[model samples]
Target: MKIATYNVNGVNGRLPVLLRWLDESAPDVVCLQELKAPQDKFPEEAIRNAGYNAIWHGQKSWNGVAILARGTDTEIKEVRRELPGDETDEHSRYLEAVVNGVLIGCLYLPNGNPAPGPKFDYKLSWFERLITHAAKLYTLDIPVVLTGDYNVMPTEQDVYKPERWLDDALFRPETRAAFQKLVAQGWTDALRKLYPDETIYTFWDYFRNAYGRNAGLRIDHFLLNPKLVGRLTTAGVDRHVRGWEKTSDHAPVWIQLKEK
Candidate 1:
């Protein structure tokens, strides 16, 4: 089965681009982030017309997440609208489901740019909650695939100009350490595990013509639990999609798994 993740930026504005990618890629399951729409404005009819069943958590104009399963409705195992420490409903960042018996989660982690403030603090606290939740899943002994725009550059190699991002929250020592802690708990960075030396990137900035110059970062990822690592047959970034007209800053990152 093929599982992919794409941050469409806005569901309504990028509907055409999304439909085109779906037709071409045909992933069995797709996790989406940054819908930037309300629940009522999700364009459910259009998505269903494209041959997929979707469950989405949407907000007005900021963060949102969704999962789309082709050919059938996915079994939603859980929807974590609020993180454990998040008392205020700040963002629609996480959603999880079970498709074809594989546990999948879609996330849009906080940007936390302008660090050393409340937002940055929230980001770290959010990571802590995510680690707690991930620990619970690790104990389940099931194949879990977590995919999305992590807003994190795991290492120096994952970014094109590492120096530019060193002071940024995404690549800060604290951020990378938090991400490493999660990986140490037994999650495999799917694409990196497959092509360790290849600079496969899934996101490029619209400013400075980053996509044209191939100045990008592999922040979007698909991290699989150890139980799912053995099933990972192939994983890659579909960078061509970023060249499409009115495309998102992010391209699709996908993985194919061996049949059970």
Candidate 2:
């Protein structure tokens, strides 16, 4: 089965582009982030017509997420709509579901810009909460694939120019450390494992002709559990999609697994 994740940026505005990709890529399962639309606005009709079943958590004008299974009969066991540990938190950044016996944790981790500020603090606090919850998932013993736009560049190799982004939130040492700790809990980063020495990237900014210059970052990820790791046969980023007209700043990252 081929599983993928895409940060669509804005689902409504980019529905056509998304539909085009869905038809072309034909992934078995997909996790989407940054819908930036309200609950009533998720383009369900278009997706269903394209032969996928979807469950989404939507928020107005900002964060939103969803999971899509490529066939009508695919079983989708709803897991959780929001990440726990914060009662007042209402961003639609996390969503989980069980598809074809695999637990899919789709997350858009906090960006946390402007270092030493409230947003940065919130990002760290959120990371700790994710750690606690992710630990519990490790005990489930079932196959789990945590996939999405993580918003952090795990290493200097993940970005185009290490020095240029040294102090930025995404490449900052503290942010990367949090991601490392998550991996330390036993999740396998599929793309990194598959392309260790390569400068793989999943996102390219529009400014400074980033995409044309091949300036990008690998923030989107697919972290698999030990069980799923055994089935990881292929991993890649659809970088060309980023160059499409009116495309998201991010690209789709995917993995193909051996049958369960």
Give the number of the best model, judged by TM-score: 2
Q: Report the Cα lDDT for residue 86, model 1.
A: 58
How high is the CA lDDT of each candidate model?
A: 0.87, 0.91
Native-vs-model 2 lDDT?
0.91
* Candidate 1, 7-89: lDDT as tens digits: 99998999999999999999999999999999889988988888899888998776999999997565555645555655775
Model 2, span 65-183: residue lDDT tens? 99999997788899899889999998888999999999999998888998768888888888888888899898788999888988899998999988999878888889999999999
Best lDDT among the predictions, by candidate number: 2
- Judged by lDDT against the true structure, how good is candidate 1? 0.87
User: Candidate 1, 192: how far from true, in Å?
Assistant: 1.0
What's the residue-level lDDT of 202 in candidate 2? 91
Candidate 2 error regions (>4 Å): none
**Weakest ten-residue segment in model 1 by summed lDDT:** 74-83
Clash totals in order: 0, 0
